[model samples]
Target: MFIMRNISIMKTFIRRRHIYIDHYDLSSTGISLNEYHQRRHSLINLIRNYIKTEQKQSSYNFTICLPSSTRLFMGPDVAYFPFKQQSDFYYLTGCMQPDALLLLNGNDETFSTNLFLSSCPMNSINDYERWYGPTITDKDKICQIFGIDSVHSIDKLNSFKIPSSSILFYNSQITDDTSTNKKNLIPFLKNFSSSIVCNQLNHFLHSLRSIKSLTEQNLIRHACQLVSKAFIKTIKNCKKNIQNEYLIHARFQYECTKLENTSMAFYPVVAANGRSNILHYQNNNQPINSDDLIMLDGGCLYKQYASDVTRFWPINGRFSSSQQQLYEILLTVQKDLIKYLNSGDKFITRGKLNILTDQYMIKYLREEFILSRTIDDDHAKRIINYLCPTSVSHHLGLDVHDCESISFSEKLESGNVITIEPGLYIPLDCTDVPSIYRGFATRLEDDVLLTDQGCEVLTSMCPKEINDLYRLLDERDNSDID
Candidate 1:
């Protein structure tokens, strides 16, 4: 969930200090400029619908500030990131400028959606454009680009007086969310008139983002294709020493951004040997030993949407007997889970129980003799967490782990983009574990889009079948032969 995107740039430092960017690209594809107008109207309508159902009808105004990371301080002349518009704000306003704000006011008949541009430190209106690149300065042109009804300067945001009774529907996720990695928005609200109250609209935004629009799905699918191409390159280039963990990581980055031209969605997990057992293991510096069955978890960003996929490969172009044994069983479990998904049963639901229980994986593990016990008893079931440490699925979109507020247990809905990953971690050092499956760690992750009849595996082009992987790697090993 906390996968970091590390893109290659010509340079990102000043003479004084080095700077790291969180996200360097904010391009939007598939989503047309005209579609933003529809989104804005839908969001405002959602707000109005929410207020109408409230115990008491309330008058309110919406306020969303661009994420502070948009123009992070690096050095005197450096900015780390390329002005990534905040997800929620962009969903509603489609504006990409830094330090800007969008206000949807019900009290004013002037305009429902008002854009407030933050002035520069030296009173230069082109502050963001000066650092990022050329940007439209004409107020009307800016409005035309963003599909906003009105535009104003942030200097006048607080001056527009509102009565004490009106509420501010705020999209600042939380005052205590330290993950933003920059200043939170709560303190900035002190500038607002004390008469107005700020109520968090975080849940409303989450609910909206859970269901992907057609444009968002297309963007995510494009990212998935890029991921598949990058993965294929990594497979074809594998070597004993030259293609270690970092090589695989570099291949993914290069193929996605350099060849296909996209951005790394997160820091890739190029885990080999025992490293795969450590979930979220990102120290991609490990060697590709003769026996290491490497686990690669990498994807790229396309048009502000994310693709996440996980694959396992044997460095020597063949899986060991133990590797084959475990991979076969695990692959079956993953397929069964996916089959169930396509059967109209909610992803993690089995009548009333979560799918991770002995209901599916545990039963299969025991049937294949992979697990010592089936986790049938209460005690065995309690240890289910140890077997598969990560959840079966998660919401995926602009953020790899999108729709944080929604519980995965709920029934799957159409337009929901989620990830289905089933992984196994067996400790090699533990003598209690059977030698056949010892030190075995395998995770098969696929990005899934829930559709009307079933689901679509968006990242399917990257082959995962044991036989398929073996053939591909063998072909690659001899690709240069005459």
Candidate 2:
């Protein structure tokens, strides 16, 4: 169920027969053009409310400008990375082309959204289109697809008019200051007076993005499900008992990509043995030791939504005593954090969740390791902090670390997606614990969605319990022997 549209250059408007994607579908992403319009409408209402409350202005005009990412080259005419649209721009307009700009002009309660796209050269053999294929350039077609008010060629932006006194809401951080794309959009901003009240749009945009719509929630759920299945497949592959970090990483990628419309969200951390002690270790080239525990922190993107998950398992399909002990402690800490969030009376923010996790980690560590009672609460906290220096939770969505502009102090409400990860890294040379635990690290991470009823773990399909993990490996071993 895909819509195929024919796009053509000016010279061969009638002769061209190449087809291009008009929009995404349920198989890829279920987001529709109307949803994009709704997002822009929400932004307009947010700005209007701010004007009424803060400025107390009966009526006012405003212009919000957002820019898309630019194409980057690695060497001579070779693009280094794939073109991913800027998140904020894609959220409002659903337009993924680079070097585009979105302009929202409004007065009182009504607003008009405009998209400025770069037009291709009008020659016989379009080099860009010849190599990369035709893009949606027709103004009417784009307006119909994105549900914007009007569409204009990017060159005309310099002449586009806006009220000089209108409030300017633009996020400077959306693109690099040195980028040519950003520089191109600067002239459009000059139309507004210097005295115009300038506000950062990311804070408001992120506030809306923090609460996922029903469609967004489903997309993220699908993303999490894909990653979970991929993890299981990778774990089973370890039955061979001769896999390396690189092979495990490749196995996970192959499993995820074999599915429809899925890609890795980020470079995975495939750490083995002492390498697990280094947080965010991504040099996935070391050989696996039969006695060493493996830590894999990887996830994939279904559509544009991302899933971030981490799991620890033994390379030999059985956990050692020390490995089991450390893994159980971390797993308990992760479970407690989720359980507390679900059962707690007061709404909890990320900061509060982090503090609670620290408390749980210290309590478990002290009880299991038999730390001296003489250690004060602050001392225990410091020790836990030293062990796991990364944040316990972060917002997850379009980007793995989604909605960065939204502060962690904000209370998590229904429809919000965040990761619950708690880990401990004990150095090989450390004297703080028994030698068996040293040089070992264990972590359990899951994608969670906050809801009115309770928090749901989206990555629950992947087994974390020791018994369940053992069952998976046992099956693998039995099958290999058979």
Candidate 3:
């Protein structure tokens, strides 16, 4: 039954780019480094055991692929390595180093794990290393530290021959294949005839990852706390004179990085005024006006795992009556959605609640003169699309928008973590929208974990209520700016 279910799921699984935040520093709540390392080691072992079990059914050996350096970065600068969290690689190895690979062999009743890494000389001269620092150089030292069975130069992969019974498992799309001379592992599988199968393993890893172990949950919770701190700092920095959105973004990033050796889970959405209407807006170059609403969607990662959270506030430390009303409506929808997030509930079915909430909001808008009464079902759908088009939630984990093979209709499990973000985007020039609702976009998002009872808000530390937000902003303005 499990095999059938997995096979059914694989048919619909489509890989999408996910964002994650790293917040490893927020975990210093009196925990020692040694204790953290011990916890990480246990997590690694747990992942290894699962991988070992998958390899048991086949006569072939198992190989884990790593992200190559070329794939990780686009330029010489450290910032060029576009932020991406490799979930499977992070799971088994617990190493966040980029441009490295891992291979495991378990054919002769002796299980061994081998790590392939870029040579040290490459890092000695690379600008990325100079700026970001090297993760690992000496293969022997890494093997000793991780207690892996073996270590090999990544360049030696092509020359080193594997037995005919070896089967390679990797993230089919996640790893970079740009290197001209590197051994193309996928092509090599075809040379071995029908016995070998190049299986895409990310989905299997995703399912396992969705259900966070006790330790993983604790790490995520800590990461969320750190992000909440950063959010508080950003709110404090929002002053009437300071208009640049990038300044706030930079401040948040600085706080997060300083606190936890991790970076933003993804490129932050720091939109002000009308720009906030763009759902994935990250170009924070706009000047924030005191009268404009600012929406910030971001998170931090802890040891490559992530926490994603979003909050919206007024630049002048208080929302206008209209802005407050719209913001409250979105927040209400988000709060209502949270009530339905639970085990055995289908995410798509839960999504229907979002549609219902949207319809209700539209009706309310019509009554309030924010929407046209003549708008038909088609126009209503378009209006809703403009307001809150995307599903109210998605899976969250190592990647901010983590991998899940199941469709939206699939049943939710107790351990799954997701986002409940309901928003309204009113463009400035839309004649269809009533005058009062123009030029405003409000989004209320929070990380949630499905529990036995219903759902737990992982990002509850960040204020979402209009009154609370106004108070928080006012407090920041009075104490910090002056």
Candidate 4:
């Protein structure tokens, strides 16, 4: 059945490969021709196996979607061309360079993979090639490299006949702008068969991605270490002269860029003083006051996987008595919460762990005179709500938020990557709080993986202890003065 489909598809090269050796220059670290090939091969096998496993239950055809052309300004002069599929393209072709598409047809008996990409301009002097560099225009070479049965220019999509019983799996979220051309091509396939379904492919792909195979885990672990080293460098570089939060953010980025496997997983949150209260703060534009507590929440992307972490420090190398008290409370809550995140444990509510942690924090606050009263009814409710706005943990993987939709009562499995973050926000204007507790906000965040026995903290390289943070800050300041 697969062989017949391939014959029917007629794999022909409509686009020629125009290899410009200069294209490699666009890569800051130069292109790894070998890595690209290896990734494609790895993905092909993984997908084949997935299809085989699925075929046992039912017969369905699989199609992968790619991101379409969208302009990304690398600089004022250089722009990046778009691609069709994201993970699908990356998995099948290992082609990071965009504006490509892929289709895989698998029946219960056989399967064939096809690559559809943009054609190279016939004119040699095309400005896009000169400005942006060469792309894979040759269908033959791509077919040879990826071992796909056939390759064709995207223009041939309309002529192709899709099997009626075939299942078309593509990203449901492909935007009109990114997939306008592909959307036109979909109608042609439907003409051949009414069985075409734009099933959600990302769910299956994300599930596979969330569980770190040995190779994937190593890549993420390397990224974690790079971020840890960058954090250390950023701390050491901190001095009295650098007041601009943007400057500090740049420093962290500079350090990460030096490492091969490191870059910000997401925008760094360099919030100082009260701004730390805003959970996803990315406007690192505030001035860093000597007396303010600075919160640095950032991570590095390792081989496309992510590592998320957060650390807090006093700008002047010493936390005041009030700051120290609040910081300790947050740290203690995080530590205790982590102890309960064991494998197979089921949480009854979405934020049950966070709620419990907040309860402990409220008790500490009342006992330490941070809160005037420990009234179990209104006071306790207010304390819990103020300290933790969201759940203490969330699924974390390739994307920072990761992708498990399973909710409370679902038992945590061993391979899940999650973040444990507990925070307390104290507003300066609040008249209800004691003077010592006002204007102080603190949060401790770390990424961890659930193991069979317990859990392992992937981002624990950064210090979280109140004493350790102060000591490191003081050491940095003292070294700077010398």
Specify the highest-TM-score model's number.
2
Q: Looking at candidate 4, what is the lDDT of residue 80?
A: 44
CA lDDT for candidate 1 = 0.67
The Cα error of candidate 2 at residue 289, in Å, is 1.7
For candidate 4, write residues 197-262 as lDDT tens digits: 545666555555555555555666677778887887788777755788998898888877778845
lDDT of 3 by residue, 388-468 (tens): 667777788777878656457655677778878777777778787767778888677788777777778888888777777
For candidate 3, the C-alpha RMSD (Å) to the true structure equals 11.7
Poorest 10 consecutive residues by lDDT, candidate 3 = 14-23
Q: Give each model a TM-score.
A: 0.83, 0.91, 0.77, 0.79
Stretches off by above 4 angstroms in model 4 are 1-69, 73-93, 125-130, 133-136, 176-198, 342-360, 366-374, 377-379, 404-410, 477-482
Question: Where is model 4 poorest over a 10-residue stretch in terms of lDDT?
Answer: 20-29
Per-residue lDDT tens digits for candidate 2, residues 1-482, read: 12233343443653232222323332234797667778888888888888888888877898888887766778887975645667888788666677778889888967788887655533432554676675554567667777778887676787888865788888867544555555567676666657465558988898999899999999999999999988888787765466578988888888887887688888898898879787768899998877778888998987778999999887777887877888888898998999987895466899888888889888887888734457899887887788888889999988889899877788898999999999888888866677778888767899999998879999999989998888777777544311
lDDT of 2: 0.79
Ranking by lDDT: 2, 1, 3, 4
Q: lDDT score, residue 303, model 3?
A: 64
Point out where model 3 deviates above 4 Å.
Answer: 1-85, 107-111, 122-141, 174-176, 179-194, 342-379, 404-406
Better of 3 and 4 by TM-score: 4
Off by over 4 Å in 2: 1-28, 121-127, 477-482
Q: What are the runs in model 1 whose C-alpha is more than 4 Å off? A: 1-28, 58-69, 73-78, 81-83, 107-111, 121-132, 171-199, 346-358, 373-376, 429-432, 478-482
